[model samples]
Target: MPVNRTVNVSVVFNCVQNGANDFGGSATYTQSSSTPSDLGNVVDSNGNIDLRQASAYDPSQYNDSVDFVFTLAPQSTGYVTPVVWASRNGAGATIVVPQGGNAQEFQVEQSSATPQLLTIVDNDDDSNTYNYKPAVELPNFDHYYISLDPRIVNKPSSTNK
Candidate 1:
């Protein structure tokens, strides 16, 4: 698709009009690998694409343009196949992190006013383990730290900080 987007995009899932509810599928997309990246968390279980999670960039730079080819795979063989129900384009937002300040005081905020960046300087600092978390979470937070980038950032504190 010729997508000229810079914000979060979503694919609405629903049963086909012909009552082909038996067939369901997940959505995913692919991007260039010329730059270092990992797309482990960008995809939804119900087949949705978030272009931001498909690539990486320096905290101060814009995301590298990506060409996402959305794909759908049917869950089971049925008389009817899955079809697009609806799609919503994204309205881009900006992330602002304070520069040259106390790293501990600064934080990375999402489009909404929420800070989800959590940093564990050392295992001795807390009982929580970082083994289960991915190497890097989405919504880059290097712009907030003084010495190191966040290992687990952009995670809602209310959910798990």
Candidate 2:
């Protein structure tokens, strides 16, 4: 099987933007920690976080790997998408190594209409440069059972982004 080498990241002017038939109103696409992306072992090591995994992962483990977090108020996506969630490392917690920490997380917005086409966006630009890329492949990415879904989001997921 081939491996994911590059993840294309982009920003969203608005989730419920006046595009895609005004698929805008206030919508967001996200996957729970159960999804491979959140716990998946597809770290980029040198580049930004794997775009594929980021798109797949929900806020479940989001706080676990990133330093700062910022999300613009829901845009005009016009669809009531589900809320994807995971066990984030929690706020004010110091990030450790080996197990990874929130300091490595990246911020990216995506489209539930096409989960597979999930895009990466950076609304916050403090000390944040890029989403945290895994230094190695997360075992969860390849193996199942390593992590399970927390059943947070109720919306239907799109294809793999």
Candidate 3:
């Protein structure tokens, strides 16, 4: 039996199917390191590939690229699986910090945007702790960039919420 080589892959955001959709009003992409990075919150974690700044630059609007990395464990499994998914952060309103910014005010107009880049949380052990354990795949050294759907950049007022 061939053992899958354990390696780290970079998680990037580009564009995907849909091409059109918005979660609330802000679009989010979670890093492979298991962090929900907002549009402007660019960051990296232990298991991340350090692709680009969350709000680094612009690539069209609705259409964007994103992906999760897979790390193989020496001889644990011959192959690993990795898949991505999209979801609505909130209703019509973009994702809000719930409690932030002045007392009663709104934050950035880019939280609950659609085509959110959600993380593949491993809920195996029954514990709700978000572990950066994503489905790993056979290491090939090859890489690709996937995009996320785009929507409107809701720039509402602080009191809009």
The most accurate candidate by TM-score is 1
Cα lDDT for residue 121, model 2?
A: 28
Model 1 clash pairs are: 27-47
Candidate 3: count the clashes. Answer: 30
Better of 1 and 3 by TM-score: 1
* Model 1 per-residue lDDT tens digits across residues 88-145: 1211211122232222322222222222222112111121212211111112222111
Q: Residue 51 lDDT in model 2?
A: 26
Q: Can you tell me which runs of candidate 1 are displaced by over 4 Å?
A: 1-35, 50-64, 81-161
TM-scores, one per candidate? 0.24, 0.20, 0.19
- Model 3 CA lDDT for position 42: 29
**What is the Cα-based lDDT of residue 4 in candidate 2?**
23
Which candidate, 2 or 3, has the higher lDDT? 2
Task: Report the lDDT of model 1 for residue 97.
Answer: 28
List the candidate numbers ranked by TM-score, top first: 1, 2, 3
